[model samples]
Target: MPKPSSTKKVKTIPVPKSIRIDLTGHQYGRLTVLGFAGYRESAPMWKCQCDCGTVADYYRCNLRSGTSTQCVQCRHADLGVRSTTHGQWGSPEYRAWEKVRQSDNVCKRWQSYENFRKDVGPKPSKDHQLSRKVTTSAWKPSNVHWVHRDNVVQQKSNSHLIRFRGRTQTLTAWAREVDLSPAALRSRLESGWTVREALTTEALH
Candidate 1:
């Protein structure tokens, strides 16, 4: 009988240890790292305390990336404020208000639902959105109005409007009229092209 072939044993590689960083006493946004919670799925976790007096576990990466902030109570409170402000949390009016507040950098004055409702009044319709009469103005009662969503878009579009050949239209509208992509036209404008050139330029296929 032929001699049995010698079998070569395969060597197993040991798993590399993860680099651990101590985040104790480090503040990330509203959270202060207290200690290491342990590991989950081969990643380190941390125990953190929020300024609002809540303690929770957060992924190590989330703290370092500024992604985790505030406790559950604060997050719920914020969502409640937004939802109660416009009769419902997921309403179109509330979402519109949120978008306007973020875009215009409106200060938060209406902490209570009553204050927000008293100032903004009731939502007229599902199709209506909170709008600012003056684009540069804040979301206060004096500056805000309930307008159709299309009207809001038109109003925002008017801000960057171009006037050429006795015609006034937004860059997007001009691009549509001239058979150019709105995104390409905007890019050209951003690159310092004149409105005429941006609107007139043919889009490359």
Candidate 2:
């Protein structure tokens, strides 16, 4: 029979009997190793504080050397009530909205124009000229106009605009449904017709 090979035993450093930590020049006695966080692939390993007032300072190699330490625990109690709002802007849906909102010139111009008018009054002024710079490829000067609050709401109630069927419809179809010509509907919409009046007159016809 072959002779049994001798196995070398690895020695481990034992936790100290007690630990002391100085916080703001005052000595804290019961500080224990809580958790650890640092670059795993580099030097300057960190020590975690425990409940027993012990601190475990080991090298990154030492941490990998054994599995004694761990990262912080996820506290469920701390999470409290869940929020009903949307996720952060970095999420997929938010990112998609953000991409169009930021990059698409047509959408950007519409938003900017509306905001500008709301904030600093109607455009077409020397300063407001900048706001009019935005337009869709098909946008025309005659097709754009300021509308009153009531007229705006009236035009929005059309089935075409509201989408009664599975498919989405256009403003032109809504206008046609109410017996108003496309030019008339566009005129009213651009002039700020309300959804209520727009839908009523269109539907009545």
lDDT of each: 0.60, 0.33
Candidates in order, TM-scores: namely 0.39, 0.21
Model 2 stretches with alpha carbons more than 4 Å out: 1-168, 202-205
Give the residue spans of candidate 1 off by over 4 A. Answer: 1-74, 77-104, 159-205
Q: How well is each residue in 95-176 modelled by candidate 1, as lDDT tens digits?
A: 5554543332354674344466668877898878776675433457787888887777667676756777889777678878
> lDDT winner among the candidates?
1
- Model 2, span 1-205: residue lDDT tens: 1212431232233322221222211112222222233322222234544333234443333233232232222111111121123223243323323233332222334333333233333333222122121222212233244434454444444422434345445767765676766666554433333444344532211
| Residue-pair clashes per candidate | 1, 28
Local error of candidate 2 at residue 5 (angstroms): 99
Q: What lDDT score goes with residue 25 in model 1?
A: 73
